[model samples]
Target: MSRYETVIGLEVHAQLKTKTKIFCSCSTEFGKDPNENVCAVCSGMPGVLPVLNEKVAEYATKMGIATNCEINLKSVFARKNYFYPDLPKGYQISQFELPICEHGHVDIEVDDEKKRIGVTRIHMEEDAGKSIHSAADNASFVDLNRTGVPLIEIVSEPDMRSAEEAIAYLKEVRSVLLYLGICDGNMEEGSFRCDANISVRPYGQEEFGTRAELKNLNSFKHILKAIKYEVDRQIDLVEDGEKVVQETRLFNVDKGITQSMRGKEEAHDYRYFPDPDLVPLVLDEAWVKQWQSELPELPRDKRERFMVEYTLADYDAALITTDRTVAEYFEAAVKAYNGEAKKVTNWVVGELLPFCHEVESEACDVKLSPEKLAALLTLVDDGTISVKIGKDIFRDLCESGDDPAEYVKAKGLAQMSDSGELEAMVDQVIADNPSEVEAFKGGKKKLMSFFMGQVMRLSKGQANPGIVTKMIQEKLS
Candidate 1:
């Protein structure tokens, strides 16, 4: 039996998809030259005032609404004083006491049991500049391009019991971010990032355990592994009668361990105080309502709709609606093919997904469009090509973006639906495989598949499987 229960909460910082920085007019675009996107306000030059970006508030409210957070009509920005080199201002302007949104929850399921994880608060803040290290040159560089990027910090309650639950929650949160068009949720590029505060308590205990905050876990796999390692480390400390220190730790992805970075600091250590330069934001009730009205159909709603309207199985619906682009691709193909939802689902999930994985990209980067996929499915439905050959054509579409019909015609890969030709091949297979035929006549009904395989092989896999099955069954009976 396990001795302890793991508890995890995540602090997710997602860079909002705004065109400009939170306070300054500097560009928020990623992958720009170091310091090129910086400005006097964002780079913290002397005597510059910061102005709020209206779009950041709008996006944050959209998220709060989506996550069921209460919109705080009035909120204040505070200065969190810190001394990291990347912090140009020697402090970060953030929301501390009065955040923009509060008391929300996100639902996640693990092992078929649904759990509601409470979101503590969602506050708007500005991102710090990045510090680039170079081991070869023994030097570090600073890039202020991301210095003033708008970010929303989503702090969750310590409600997760295991790594699986944590991952499920993160995925849902990321999906919501994507669906709202607020963030790209790209961990590689730091658009979306997570820091986990994890601890392990004795099972059934009401009090919480000593926790360590794990940072630098950029990917889902990294999150899972880091949580697992931290939990085990804490539990072992307890069993050994050693005290677990509360501190900040960094995940060493290469070594699969967490090392202490610094002692955890209390809120007072940062000297949190209201920013005197910026005025408290007073949001209009009408404006908040307008933002809510413009909210798009979120991922969970879209998943349920896909199951109902598309008449899809629960698994199919979940997989199709997991990503916005993939969901749109499924719907577009279904529409173009005139509502053959199940057929299109099969092709997209089975064939197109593997092709995407092979090419190291997502559905959005796919070269095959819905119109082409619809045309390919039409060929299979009309018996112009076997589903087997259509799979081959799907591969061609994935690789080269060629038209499916043109590929089939150019390669002479049309299905052999001609009854006379299939019948002759079926008879020849029956004669050549006398033992199998006798076994089938003697009661081995499964031998029909053996004969069908032979017929299909004889037809070079171009035979319409339906027609060949019918023709083969007739000759054998």
Candidate 2:
């Protein structure tokens, strides 16, 4: 028996975030009435000449520069001939021989090791329409609304050895697209979709094995599972003296199985040819350089900077920089209040994150602005309010966007930080919890927590816990 290794490559199709469909004037909005966003060009009516969307080219160029790809000076669109009810044009206008980008790479961290995955090509293409299958009956319907929408298919080399690597690569790519504002990167809305090509071969084998293309893996978790299952399935076939067949398979997320869609179509199967209707795209050095300047700091660089500048750990930086909105929010909070890194991080990660999810909003729309959060943290730091009381005021600020210090004073929620006031409260707590006081005297110093709890309850959670604890220890001693 020969040992085997799994090899996987990914082909990710990301829809560019443009206002209108490529080559047409149709609105590129999702969830419109079926075909409501379609127009004559997108619907493939007769006698319409396809006009190129300039923004698509700019987006492609931006992605190419970001991924370290070579921008093709001239790229051509070709006719991918296929017949499907959803595709009104009967052929998708896409780049085949000459794509907008080539030979790029993205570095992904897997198992604490950074591995570079090679990007074979990134090509521009028009999307096909969507097909809707009815649950009530054995009926299927087609919607041409998405037809002629612009997409860039990023093809990666077979450089991944495990499912983790594949998912990391996918996440990194999605983050790049989102950071660039080129794609919304929504998997559920079909804005960013991924199809994987996977195979298994003996360890150190030079030749590759038969590969299966898996599609409809919408989420990151599903992608990981699908790749793992496919790898196992292929290895099992080889072990049982069977050969893995080359085919296109669809992942049934609910069933957790891959079903064959069709025999895998080779490149020649589509009979690719330069589209006669549209002219070749020509990009100059000046044009490419202009788009390059617009590129922001990508995920890797941003993550490192966050770690260095804010003294955050790798996980914290990764979480903060995963989305552009979160990163901006964090930076704003840091700027608003000087040298309160940990406080800002706690509120952003703990309170703001859950609040965003609760209201079903992106981080960009977080009701508690970074300046406001910083102000709240400052209130706690300056002893204007206890940490517990600050949290309550912060929640009110999140709801009403009011000033934290003013809210605390107006609501009489300020901490009893005066030594005289807290001393009296500490005495009451010590008298009430005699067992805890005895325990503390007997060297079970952890009973300090019990005394602290009683103090908090007596103060109605308005006492400064640090002051109360210190005053209690002094009085008890």
Candidate 3:
């Protein structure tokens, strides 16, 4: 271990799943034509007064409650002054001194050890437009479609000590956002993105080393790699008797290094002042209560319930509960199957999840409905189809959403349990491989697997292994 320790804090910006801009009626749709979704308010036209979207405030409050944050009865929006081509207003409307949420925390587990990462604040802000650069043409274009999109910036305390801890904390927070159905958590499309603040100090030091803020970490894999790279880079500077610069850096994904973008700015640099056009957002107690009442079972709670109620292993429970749709699918399937929960878990985690990932869709959107999945698993459990046959037909089941029993009958895919048929296949295997049969009789009982494979192949993976094994053993023994 190195003598120095790494401290990391993350600022995650999650785009609200709202329909319109935070302060305007313009659509908050992604991938629209340039400026198509823009209006005078979002485009920063002169003399246009901004109107606060009630849905934005409500969404922000829901997130605050879900994260265990203290919901401020009154929060003020301030103009964050900045100059960028994408920021058409020359200043962005954001919350500073009186953010909507504060003093929240998320618990994360790293290497089987639990740690709580404090959420310093979750402030609501309006997003700036995208600046698409055309390197070939040596020009940049601004798309105001994303302007004024509602965002909640979740800032964490510098409580993490390692990259592993940082990643675990990020994943936990993202899981919560996904479970709440507030943010889509699509890191690739920038719905959810994180910036890392990294510093290294000696083992006994009380003061922190100069920190570098890493940006452009759009994915979790990139975040982990960037954090590790930045930590090592800072340590190298310190060891070489060079002072670390406090600056903003962008991760060069291809080079796997952080390059300085610009010097970091202090909060006072933004010249934060409350916007006069919009009144202070005062959330009513009744409204807060209603939002709180609407809160679904969060990820941690659902994970715990899965363990106790479903008797799932911790790892399996974590996988199922990571996404709300997947968790709901599991419960619905279990209820529909009305069988062992672990059995449903196996098909879910082992088969269904892989298909979901492959198709880049959630379980809720997939063709394999919970009832359909339950029916398929029921066929496997009832011995109507062998496990191997179930595996073979799973993709078809997922695509066609066909009744498993009906599909089996239509495809002639039922398990072959007849004594006469299985015995003939087993005898044929024994006759075909005399040396293997002799070896089995001479204490090479493991050759039973070899015969079983042949019999299963003859039946096209529909042979009932239980009866086939009994017949093969009786003949060979």
How does candidate 2 fare on TM-score?
Answer: 0.95
Deviation (Å) of 6 in candidate 1: 1.5
> Which stretches in model 1 have alpha-carbon errors above 4 Å?
357-367, 398-403, 427-450, 474-477
Which candidate gets the maximum TM-score versus the true structure? 3
Please give the CA lDDT of all the candidate structures: 0.90, 0.88, 0.91
Q: Compare candidates 1 and 2 on lDDT and give the better one.
A: 1
Candidate 2 regions off by >4 Å?
Answer: 392-395
Q: So what's the TM-score on candidate 1? A: 0.93
Q: Per-residue lDDT of 36-142 in model 2, one digit per residue for the tens?
A: 99888888899999999899999999999889899999999999988898988888999999999999999999768999999999999999998999989889999
Error of 1 at 216 (Å): 2.5
Q: How many times do residue backbones clash in model 3?
A: 0
Error of 3 at 26 (Å): 0.2
